[model samples]
Each structure stands twice: as structure tokens, then as C-alpha cells.
Target chain A: MNTQTIPPLAPDAPVVLEMTNISKSFGAVTALVDVSIRLRQGEVLALVGDNGAGKSTLIKILSGFHQPDTGTIVSQGKEVRFASPRDARAHGIETVYQDLALIGDLSVFHNMFLGREYHKRVLGLNLLDNRKMREQAQLYLDTLGISIPSVNSTVDLLSGGQRQCIAVARSIYSSPKILVLDEPLAALGVRESAHVLGLIQNLRQQRQVSVILIVHNYNQIFEVCDRINFLHSGEIALDASTADTSEEELIRIVKSGLGRKAIDAAAAQVRPGPA
Target chain B: MPPTAIQPTKKNAVGVKVPRTMREQLLILLSRYREASIAVVAIVLVIYFQLGSDGGFLSPSFMSVVLRDTGRLGLIATAEVMLMITGEIDLSLSAIFSIAPYIMALLSVTYGVPLAVGAVIGVLIGILVGAINGIVTVRFKVPSLITTVGTLFFLQGIVVSIYNSQPIVAPVEQPFNAIFGQSLYQPTDALLSWHGVTAFTPFLWALLVVLVLALVLNRTTFGLHTIATGSNIIGAREIGVRTDRMKIYNFMIAGGCAAFAGIINTAQFTSADPQAGSPFLTLQAIAAAVIGGTSLLGGSGTVIGALIGAFVVASLNNGLVMIGAQATVSDIYLGAAIIAAMILSIQVDRLRTRRRV
Candidate 1:
């Protein structure tokens, strides 16, 4: 890997997101412990780990879906604790899960404006302002560069790519400070994945939005991320600038942890065979 | 707009809505007004048949009978429509309806209480029955159809055991009897009676209640929530909507309505029959709501449509009887109509979805 200057986590960097010494446990299972990371303004942080490496647990804690047993999360230098997902959202942190939480039968406008729908005065006060919601959904889709047969169209009729775009657009339209995408490109086709990657790049370049992308593929990380955070054994094994580390070093740390285990030698197959 | 600001986009690449075909438009129109059409057809057919077969079918006495008949079934149908919209079926309502009069009879005859107090006690019995239904479904998570059916039989048995299958009657005073036991139209039983006019009963009250509920269901936020919770419970819950509470309330409403229907029936006859309203529990509701274009799946139904649907069902029965037809024949016709409406609703939903494509 080419050697380049890796920016240090400093107060002068204008950090948008900061997590210090976060630890979480679910009953007897220790999901994450002593994890700390910093995200600068307009930077994408790629979080990669194996299946049981507590990626989901960490995301849940950050997004306020799960409370960390021992940790303090600070947003923009202010100590913050989220009691619920809504609370996290209030602080401009949003997580778009794999399911997308989109209903199939409802119109796009209805789905987008759910829980907080704009209402118009009807004959004084007793009617729905459906026109406003429809127009608002239109404006959002326009901003996201998405096309469909009117905002009245049921989301089920939209393509998989369109649905993901809808989810992304819905989160970002409200101008969330940090957009947490969970496996966004996982089940998408080549075309859909390309569209999503383009969207991510645009979000960073054009909108200057910060992303905390949870992905399994290291190629995706190297392609789009400014920094890579490697998690193993419920802890941050390595957090380095993408330019300062190769894929080889990541493999080395993951394999070394497995080599010490006494179980049926499964780590050799996953990392690589002895050469 | 600034040059850097993103511009609006089109819904389709073609930049046009896929206009609904004429045939498709017709079908959509038919579906929207299917209940109304059914109701109109039923009314015309009833009058035509009454004219052909019975000389007295269009008479004032016959008209009064129709109102009395429609009132009992209309109230029951209202209960069913409300319950069904919440994805629940209350079979116990039939039994509750059957014994509500007994509650009044027991209060008045056995306890020597005033008739007004007896009537109040009877309505309370209705409230209690609804509460039981709500509790069972909420606590056990068992499907309401099964729970309600079990309660139906249990309540029926209790009624029969208490009443010995005999009708109970108590001496009600002039004013109490007048309000509950007479019809609004032709206030006196005999128009040219020598005695003072006795007020009409039951029918107007049922109609008023149905009209008010229709307003409540259509013109209120509660109505919108009802459809939302019924159609997509998970979606509603995700938005912090209290869905379980809505269902529990719906159960209570249906129960209370059924009891009121029973009270109305007892008032009309001034007697208590333990077996009253036994068969009409699900049937009347199914008929009214389905006829009114209310999706049996819940999420989509109108109170006005349900009321109209009730009239259609009532007319079908009344019309058949006026034509000297048997109840069996009417049942067969109603069954066919139910199947047709279900098919129509399914088609309408498909067309709506296809419009997006």
C-alpha cells in the first residue's frame, strides 16, 4: 500500500461523531467491549467484522436500538444518551436496516410521511391534507433522482433498487448528521448496487453527508471508505486510515486471533490455509 | 431555483400517467358503488314483489313491521361490522342479545325494581359481556372467532337455564312502555284510536345509532386509525399507534351494540326470549358489511356502506317473505351475493395495484 499521511483524531478536525470506551453485554454474551472510534465531518467509516463479531450489537447501541451497559456517546462534543431510536434520530443519527421498514401496499407518500405526516386544513379542520404529502414525496424523490409512476404508486411495485433509494432518501432528506447503512448493497443486483454506490458517493461529494457503513465486503470498504475499523473478539482490533493499511494486514490480525483457539480449526479455512 | 439546487424529476420515464382503460374505469366505478347498487336493487325488488304477491305488503302496518324487522338485524349487523373491521368475530354477541331482555326481566320481576332501572341494568349486562370478550382475546391471544363462539354457547346455556326457555314479561308504566314499546311513525297503534296516541319504538333509535356510528367511523381520526390498524397492524405499531387498545375497544363496542340490539328487540315485543338473536350474530354483520363494500379482511370499510348493506339484507328477507318465499330461499340468495362481493373487492384491489405498474 502507498504510504500517505493519515489524519489523527484531533479536536481541530471538527469531529461530527465521537464514541469513547463503549461496552455492551446481552445477558452472559459479551457483544462489545472497550470500543472507541471517531468520525470527522463528511467522512465515511467502514465497520467490518465476521458473523459473531457483534457488528449488529454495536450498530444497535449507536442507533439507540440497544443501550450500552458501559459507555458514553458524544455527538458534536456534547455527551448524549439515547433512550430509543426516536431519541437517536432527534440527535441526527439514523440507521436504515436491511428490511427498510417499508410497507408494500401503501403509497410512496404515505410511507415517506408516516408518523409525521403534513396535514392541510379541510373545510376548517376535519380533513386529510393528502395533497401535501403527495407533493412532498414527489420533491424528495426528485432530490434523490428517483422516478416512479407518481407518489401514489404502491412501493411494492417499485424495483428493489428503487426501494433502497427510497429508504436512503427518506433518512437523508431530513438531513440526518450521520447516516448508518446496514448491508445496503447485500441483496441488490449489479445495477442496483451500482446505483447505491453512486448515491453514497453523491451523498459524500455533493451533499457532504457522513456515512457509517456496516458491510461484510472489504472491497466495498477500500473503494468508498476514508477509514477502516476492523472488529474481532467484540473489540476494535484495528482502526486505521485506508491508505495506511493493506487488505493483507486485516487478514493477518483476524487469522492470528483464530490460530489460538482450540476448536475444530475453522479459522484456517475462513482466513487462508497455511502457506 | 439556484443552479446548484437539484431539479424535480418525473414519476415515469414516459412522463405520463397510465390512463385507466374505459372497461377498467367502469369496473372501478362498479366496485365503489356495488353496495349502493345492491341496496337499490333490493329496495325495488322488495316493492315489486310485495305488489305482485301480497295486497298488504305496501300498507302502513306492513311498513311498520319492516322497520321493526330491520331494526333488530341492523343493530346486530353494526356490531359485526365493527368487530370484523378489527379482524375479530364475536359469536358470543348472539347469546348476549338473546339474554339481555332477561337481565331486564330479572331486574324488574324478580327484584321488584322499576322498569327504567331494569333497562339500565340490562345495558350494563351488555357492557359486561363485551368486557369478557375483550379480556379473553387480549389475554390469551386466541383468535376471537373461537373465543366468541365458546362464549356464545356458554351465555346461551346460562340464559336457557335461567329462563327455562319461556318468555318473561313485566308490567311497564305508560311512559316507559311508550318510549321502548312503540314506533315513531303512526305513534298510536291504531291511527283513529279513542285513547291518546302511544309513541313509536325501537326502529328510530336503531337508525339514529347507525347514522351516528357511520359519522364516527368516516369523519373522525379514530375511524382512520381503525382501518390503519386493521390493515397493517405492524405498520401502525411501528408509528407508535396503540393497536391492541383499538382492538379491545372494538370488542367492547360490538358487545355493547349487540346488547343494545337485544334491548331494542325486547322493547319492541315487551318480552324476553333467551333464544333471541341466536342465529343473526355473524350472518347479519357479514351480510351488511360485505354488501356495503367493506373488506372482510378489515382495514377498509365504511359505516354508511355497512348501514346500507344492512338495509339490503333486511329488504332481501322482508321482500322474500312478502313474496310468500321461504327463509331458505333468501339464505341461498344472500350466500351467492356474499361470494360475488368478495370477488368484486379482490378485482378492485388488483386494478388499483396494477395502476402503479
Candidate 2:
């Protein structure tokens, strides 16, 4: 895999979100154990793992879909608790699930303004300001450099890449401080994946939006992500900056189920840095 | 880019720009609007009936009958359109319709309650039943079809047992009938009088209801949320849409509309029948909604389309009679028309999809 070289975040960049020793379980099955991750401001952190590696569990916890059995989450400088997805959203955390959460029968603008619709009172009745929404949706898409036929076009007609981009754009439009994306490109072709990657890169440049991207492809991680966190057996086995890691090492670590100690040794060999 | 800058343009093979012909343009427009296709069907039926009946179908008296039929069916179908868009169906709406008018007549004649007040109470009962259906289906996670079917039989039984399979005549001196269902005007000579085009009060009420609902569905946030709920319940809930409330509200609206339709029926005939709301009436409402391009599967529909669908169904019944067809033959033709309309709509949907590609 070809790794693209991008500027690394400053070492002194403040952490915007921190999850410490998070653990969760379902009935008798342990989905996550002592998992922790940190997100820096304006950084794209790729969370990579095989299927059933507890990546979804961790993401759901952060997005307020599931509660961690043990742990605390700190946003900015203060500890916070999310009781529901809406609560998490209110605290500036937005998640775009794999399904995109888009109503396929609705138009693009309608999907963009799904939950937060604009309204104008006419004859004492609050009617949807469709014209305003259409204009704003078009403006937002254009500003993000996303292209589609029309805002009025129904979402189902769009390609997978377009849909994924729309989902991301919607999250960004809400101006969330941290955006969590779950397997956004899992169903896209090579070209479509490239389209989404380009969108992520563009978003990083355009705003101070922090991202937690859950993906399976190493190439995608190297292409747009600033850092990588590898989950193995419900724990984060590897956490390193992309600048100090190689695809061969990542592949080896992922394939062998190497624990955090081995990854620390490997990371140390590549770069002697404070543990 | 500005919203208007992104006009939909067609590209053919090799990515060359292709200007569409007038016929193709019209077809594309028709495909975009679900109501347009049904509107075309209604118009064609009208012209055919006018010619087949040697202009007699266009007579004011005959037109009055068609309008009245359309109005009653349209009211029920409008309610169905709202409920269906939320991925719910109210089979009990017919039962509500049957019982509401009986309750009104019972209160007005038996208890000597004010006619207007009794009518309002009757409609409220319909709303209450609808809320119950909504609550049971949503809270218990019961399939709406099963819940509504249960209510349907339960309410029907109540109507039959209470009224004892008898009919009650509405008070002839009640002036509320004039506003609800009495004819406003009739053409004296029947020479295409526009003033008497829509003489039936029920037709007028249907027209008013359809226009208001069309506005609500197309222009209101609640309508959009309703569409979202029907389109994807999980997605809607994720966005904090309170989808259960939306479903309940739609049910209430369905019940209210159905009850109003029953009241109109009572007003028009000046009587309330214990066996008024039959399964056939429920089927006709569903049929009207479907023929007007509303999907039974939900997520997409138009109120205007439902009204036009009712018109098509009513016109076929009226025209078939005017042409001297037997009742059984007319039933066959109506069934065939429903199937044909469904097929045509599906084809149009395919055409739209292909054109987009």
C-alpha cells in the first residue's frame, strides 16, 4: 500500500476528547475491555481493527448509543456523560453510522436538514422553508466541494460515494467538535472511496473538526488519517502516529494479534519517543 | 453554487449533452410528480365516459352523483394516505366511520343533545379510537395491521350490538346538515353550468380537505418528519424525531378524517346505518390511495393523487352505470383499473430511474 505523506499534528496540540479505560459488555459477552483513545483538535484518527474487534462497541459508547460499563469521557477540559445520542450531539459529538441514517425517499436538501428543519410562519402556521433549505444545502455542499446533480434529487438515486459524502457533510454542517464515522467507505468502489477520502482531506483543511474514523483498509488510513489505533481482542493494541509507522509493520501487527507490548517495542525501534 | 445553477441535464452515451424532445420532457415531468400520472388517468376516464354516454355523463345530475361518490371515498383515502406514509394502516378507520355517525344520531335523537355538539363528540370518539390504535401499535410493538384489525372487529361489534342492526334517521330540522352534506346548487338545464359543477356539499368538503392536506404534506415540517418516519424509523429516531408521536398524530388524523366522512354520509342520506362501514369501504379507500400513486409499502405518496384516484374510481362506477353495465361488470372493471394503474405507475418509476442513470 502506498502511504501518502501529510503534515503531522503538532505535538503540543491539545486533546479535544479523551476516553479512559472504557469497558462494556453485553449479557455474558465482553465487547470491550479497558479500551482508551484520545482525539486531538483538527486531527483525523483512524480506528482500525478486524471484524468483532470491539471498534463498533467503542464507537457506540462514544456516540451515546451504548454506555460503557466502566470509564469516563472528557471533552475539552471537562468530564461529561452522554445519556443518549442527542445528548452526545448537544455536546458537539456527531456520528455518521454505516447506514448513513438518510431517508432514501427524501431529497438531498431534505436529508441535509432532516432533524433541524427551517420554518417560516405563513398565516400563523409554521411551514417548512423549503426554498431556504434548498439554498443553504446547495451552499453547504458547494463550499465543501461536493458535487451532485441537485439538492432536490432524492437520496436513493445517488451513488454510494455521494451518499457517504452527504452524511459526512451533514455532520460537518452541524459544526460538531468531534465527528465519528463508522466504516464510511465499506460499501464503495475504488473511485468512490477516493471521492470520500478527498472529502475527508478537504474537511481537515476547511475546519477545526476532529474526527474518529473507523475503517478496515490500511491504505485508507495512510491516505487521510493523521494517527492509527488498532484494536485487538477488545483492547487498543497499537496507537501511533502515521508518520512514525509503516504499512508492513501495521500489517504484521494486525495479522499476528500482537499485544500492546510488541507494538510499543516496534514503535520504539522506529522512533525513540516518550512512552 | 446557487441552488438554481444545478439544473438537471441529460447526458447520453459517450457523455455527450442531449436535448430532450418535448415528448420526452413531458414524460420526465410526469414521472417526477406521482399525482400527474393519476391526474392523466382521471382526465382520460372523464373524456371516455363523456363520449361513451353521448354527453349524458357530463350532465349536472350525473356529475353530482360522481362528485358525491368521489368526495366520500376521497376523504377516507386522504386519511389512508397520511397513515400509510408513516408505515401504518388503520383498518379500524372504517369501523370508526360506521360508529361515529351512529353515536351522533344516538346522542342527538335519543339524548336530545344539540346536533352540532353531538357531531363534534362523535368525531372526538373517532379520534380517541385512533389514538388507542396508535398507542397499542407503538407501545406494545404490535404490528399495526393486527392491532387495527382487532379494533375493526371490536368496534363493529359495538356498533351492531348497540344499534341492534337498525338505522336511525337524522333530525330533518337540523341545519348542520346544510353545512356538512346538503347540496348547495343544481343546474336547471344541465348545459355545462360551471356554477353548479360541484353541487354536493360533500364534494366541496372533500376538495377543501384535500387542498389543506396537500399543503400540510408538501409544505410543513410535521409532514416531512412523517415522511422521514415512514422512510426509516431508526434514522428518524436517531435524529430525535419522536417518531412514535408522529405515528400517533397521523393515526389521530386518520381517525378524524374517517369520522368526518361518516358524518358527511349521514348528512347526505339523512340516516345512520349500523352496517354502514363495511370491509368493502376499507378496501375501496386503500384501492383509491394505491391507484392515485400512493405506495402501500410507505415512504412515498401524495394527497392530491389520492383525491384524483378517488375521482377515477368514482367515475368508473358512474360511467359504467351510465353505459348500462351490470353491477358485477362494473366491479370487475374497477378491479382491473386498480391493477392497471399500479402497473403503469411501476413502469413510470422504472422510466424515471433509467433516465437518471
Q: In terms of lDDT, which candidate is strongest? A: 2
Residue-level lDDT tens digits of model 1 in A35-98: 8878887788888877778777888788887899998899988999988677888898877776
Error of 1 at A203 (Å): 7.4
Error of 2 at B43 (Å): 2.0
- Angstrom error of the Cα, residue B112, model 2: value is 3.1
Q: Name the lDDT of candidate 2.
A: 0.83
Q: Lowest lDDT 10-mer window, candidate 1 chain B?
A: B1-10
TM-scores for every candidate against the unseen true structure = 0.72, 0.88
What global local distance difference test value does model 1 have? Answer: 0.70
Q: Which window of 10 residues has the lowest lDDT sum in candidate 1 chain A? A: A266-275
Off by over 4 Å in 1: A1-97, A103-107, A117-148, A151-275, B1-17, B30-64, B67-69, B99-101, B108-132, B163-166, B170-220, B351-357
Best by TM-score: 2
Q: Compute the TM-score of each model's chain A versus the native chain A and list the values.
A: 0.83, 0.91
Clashes of each: 6, 0
- Compared with the true structure, all predictions reach lDDT values of 0.70, 0.83
